[model samples]
Target: MTRSTDRWGVTGTVTATASATRAAAPDSATVAVTALGEAASAARARKRARNRAATVRTAIEATVEVGIETVDHRVTNSAVTFEPETDAAFRAVEEFHVRCEPDAVATVVVEATDGGGGVDHVQFALTDTARADLQAEAMTAAVDRARRKADRLAAADGLAVGAARSITTQPARPGNEPVDDAWESDPSVHPAPISVTERVEVEYELTAAETDMTVANDSGKG
Candidate 1:
């Protein structure tokens, strides 16, 4: 009976040890939860670092601007013509055409007048080549003026004028385009001025030249 009692007591002790071991076992689920938390924390830190870097980059770049203006000169050349015609009633008509020959003339206009008698009037345009030559002359004059101006400016600044960088010319507007019916009915406006204008834009560079100078002293008293 003592042996049996001892055996039963030993068995009961073993069972209790097993139960304690089961209770102390770690939960795999809890391990996964701790790992997830660590991963989330690392991701948040990376995102914050990226955002800060972007902000720094944005603050590094900005800018300002400036502007400049220049002007050019032009000239206008013109000619006038008139005609008188006497018929049933002092009626006269004047007409003109653009001439390009003997001179470069544009905007030839025509007008009619009641001269109180019957009179016939006729007007012709100058040669086209002549008008074109005139226009060329006008452009030449403008270029000369521009060169002179550049020379003067350079002289004032103690610099030498260099070669022209660029040059451009534009045609002038015709005068006929400006006349209306109001001017057509009045004889006072009979000989409308025909004009052609030319514009020139020029650019020149400036340079400096070296020169030698000497000093001399003169004293009569000495």
Candidate 2:
């Protein structure tokens, strides 16, 4: 006859999957500023475009924030009007990005756009410290959810929970939805919540049932 000890293996393992989410407030804001100029002469158009860019840079320097940084300031287009009317006319457009303390986003936007610039889009994001903290919480919540589900499933199968045999985790990313655009114009407008979600699939071993049943049956035979 085959012995129960020889048959012991990974049989009757239960797998559980679940996901958890948590919201965190964003700590930084990014804004895009663009400028366009048209002139009767190519030289005049170039000078106006340069002046517009300079105006934006100076405005940025005057603004107060925890800290402000500019990046990717570029000229998108600069050409003379030839197809429509070659009357020595030219047009130019330049764009730049600004990152600053969350609270200062609206003021910086207003000041930068005062020089005939337009806002392209605004993004609110988490700080390093906040991201780490939220990620930890989300993972714990996901694992706990998996454990609870496993317990119920194992009990229904007339088995008890045991050590985890294997586990898989899903990394976190930026929230799926964008923050409110209106917050760009009015800093007082609270941003929509930023969320982090995590998913985990865990396989847990279930205690052997035949071993205990055999002992009971032997006692009855005695």
Candidate 3:
């Protein structure tokens, strides 16, 4: 009887072990399904966030502004001809204005003699600072005019004009520098115009601050 009881107890222990192994298999499968569901949800959320960011980036890139340039110029000239014994005498008078302050000199001696035809010596000097001041004023005025024109253009194009980024002033190219036969024929008659020009380059930033056209309409109504 003792042997039979011991054999029954061993059989019960084996049966219990088999039941627990079968249960564990189903539990593991359930846990794997739950984990896979969580991973899929997380991936979908990440993709949505990336798409939103890409849309904003595209909008900003489209609203960037382009740069523009404006220019202004003014030119004037003076003539001086004298009966000097030699070319050297007229040249000396012209040289006098070289060291003199631009403000002090009114007349600019161009040449000592008209080499084209046997004429008396001539001298021409560019009036210094005082005359340049007048030209500078004219140039500044021209710049203002250009700015107005730019404003009108910006308005027409639906753009906003920003402050000037840079400004430059350059003398007009001298007519004498060009050896056109037409100009040489009457060098005295065709004196080079003294020129003062102003140029500016400006940068403007453009943006479509909101996607909703309603925002623009609200602003207008307000």
Report the lDDT tens digits of candidate 2 across residue range 128-191. 7887787789878988999999888876665666788888986544553323333545656767
What lDDT tens digits, residue by residue, belong to model 3 across residues 28-83?
00000000011123344334433433343233224332111112111111123344
Regions of candidate 3 where Cα sits further than 4 Å from its true position = 1-120, 170-222
Show where candidate 1 strays beyond 4 Å: 1-124, 170-195, 210-222
TM-score for candidate 3, residues paired by index: 0.30
Q: Supply the global lDDT for candidate 1.
A: 0.30
lDDT of 1 by residue, 136-160 (tens): 6666767777777666765654445
Candidate 2 vs 3: which has more TM-score: 2
Ranking by lDDT: 2, 1, 3
The 10-residue segment with the lowest total lDDT in model 3: 27-36
- Give each prediction's root-mean-square deviation over alpha carbons: 50.5, 5.2, 44.0
